[model samples]
Target: MSRDEVLVSTDWAEQNLNTDGVVFAEVDEDTTAYDNGHIPGAVKLDWRNELQDHVRRDFVDRTGFSELLSAKGIGNDDTVILYGGNNNWFAAYAYWYFKLYGHSDVRLLDGGRKKWELDGRELTKEEPSRSATKYVAQEPDRSIRAFRDEVVDAIDNQNLVDVRSPDEFSGKLVAPAHLPQESAQRGGHIPSAINVPWSKAANEDGTFKSDDELRKIYGEAGLDDSKDTIAYCRIGERSSHTWFVLRELLGHSNVKNYDGSWTEYGSLVGVPIENPSEQQEA
Candidate 1:
């Protein structure tokens, strides 16, 4: 997929704010940010409550996803434009979810909320009212999703991109600094995985870097574009951003986001782990 196919500029998004057949959704790590003020007519998708399954550790099932979209007044054919804070982290995650359920025309608002705010774009507290539609979602596309078993097997066979902070990658912290340092039984990265912080793919304005720069960024890190790649982070949102960079922007054919990520991988008893911090301590 080309950059234009998956990303729309903030200016373009502003022009399409009221365009029919187009839907804007804000998915932020700080879910409450939407309530404060957001792009006019954009809907709020609470990542924790709406996107994730309530009873299980997995994502919302197809039926649940359909219901959520239906309630959000989104149609199957709507051109979904997703944006959010933190350089589109949760937004890309929601974008990934849209693809997983076969939404054909989903794109990210380049630069997301950060750039919009930086440009002094208009934000509103009033929510738009639209009649809900009965949206149908397709079966989960496992092609872009990596399970624990697949991630384990890919350790040495495929490219494992640990899109986490260096501290987390080195086992100095189990999670990001802002969050509690606990989630997994152990701390470290998957053996043979290379650390590539997801933020590297985006500029200060929150827009993704150019394709050539992206290729060089990963290539210099020893990533083989020809090999199947799996990206992972603590709970998978950050890695989803990297997954978008690799799969959608870079056009890598076989790239998957292991949603379980370190939370699952680090807890597995038999999996091989490389804790540089531990090695240093020893």
Candidate 2:
């Protein structure tokens, strides 16, 4: 999908919140903040909270995922728009999940809450009500997803892009402080995977940078759109944003998101981690 086709602006949403067949989902993982205020007519869902059952290190619990989407008034053909407090962080993951379940016509709100609040847009304190609907999940496109088994196969077959901070990629750290360290389960990135942190795709204000800038950044990291790229970060959140850029924005046809990401891969039966100095000292 083209960048223009996949991202809607806050201005557009402000004008069309109640448009027919268009639904706004505010995937603001922070419930307290969402309760205080959110886009008027927007529905809220926490990526993890709505999940029914996730095996340690997996993205979504399949049967449970279908049920959650069905209960949220989301259907296969609806035009779904997503946003959140963070610069499309959880929003991107939500988008990926919906797409995985065969939902077409999904888009992310560009700039997200930062841009909305910056524009002095009005927000609502009322919580959105859930509406039940029927949804059909199609066969998952395995190419756009990754599992522990595929990851091992990818070690020599494709380019694995570790979209985490340098420290985390180097195995110096496991988890972000807000989450438990034990949640990481293991400590490193896929072997030979290039390190290109997800923050490289956005600016301090949470809005994405210009296309020229993004192109240069990805190019410098040896990430070319022509190659098959698989991206992963802790729990698959950050990498989803990168996946958006590479797949939706840059139009890389072979881009995939390793939803299992570091948490799953690290804790797998046994995967080796390479320290930063170990690479340098080599």
Candidate 3:
């Protein structure tokens, strides 16, 4: 897919703020950021409470997803424009989730809230109101998602991109430094996986780098475009950004985001692990 197909600029978003069949939703790591201030006419999607299953360690089922969009007044035919803080980290995750449920026209706001704010655009505390719709959702798309077994099988065969910080990949930290350093039974990236932190794909303004720059970044890191690829991080959110880069922007045909990621993989039994921190200690 082309960049324009999957991403919309801040200018485009500003112009389409009131356009019919276009919905703007902000999804952030700090779910409360929306309450503080958000783009006019945009809605808030709490990633923790709205996007995830309360009873299980998985995403909300298809029915729940349908209910969510219905409650948010997001119809199946609407074009979803997702944006958020931390360089659209959770927004990209939501984009992947939306695609998983077969939403055809979802796109990320290029540069997200960060760039918008940096550009001195207007933000509002007011929320929009709209009547609900019967938002039907399709079954989850397995092609763009990876499970634990598939991850293990791809260890030596596919392009396993560990999109975590150098510290996390080397087992020095289990999570991002800003967040609490707690997650997984152990730390370290999957064996044979290349370390390509998701932040590398973004510019200082949170906008993604040009297509040529992105290609060179991954190409230098040994990513083979012909092979299928899987990207994972602590909890899969950051990796989703990279997944968007590789699949949607770069147009790599076969790439999946392993949402189970390190939180699931590091805690599993009988799975091979390579802890560089431990090796250094030895």
The alpha-carbon lDDT assigned to residue 114 of candidate 1 equals 95
Clash pairs (backbone) in predicted model 3:
none
lDDT of 2 by residue, 162-247 (tens): 98888788776787645656656656678879898888899886777777898898889877566688899987888889989888
Lowest lDDT 10-residue stretch of candidate 3:
28-37
Cα error, candidate 2, residue 83 (Å): 0.7
- Model 3, 1-282: lDDT tens per residue? 888899999999999999999999999857678998999989899989989898899999999999999999999999999999989999999999999999999999999999999999999999889789999999999999999999999988999999999999999999999989889998998999999999899999999999999999999999988899999998989999999999999999889999999999999998999999999999
* Candidate 1: regions farther than 4 A off: none
Ranking by lDDT: 3, 1, 2
lDDT of each: 0.94, 0.79, 0.95
- Pairs with backbone N, CA or C atoms under 3 Å apart (clashes), candidate 2: none
TM-score for candidate 1, residues paired by index = 0.98
Model 2 CA lDDT for position 239: 88
Q: Locate the minimum summed-lDDT window of 10 residues in model 2.
A: 51-60
Candidate 2 lands at a TM-score of 0.89
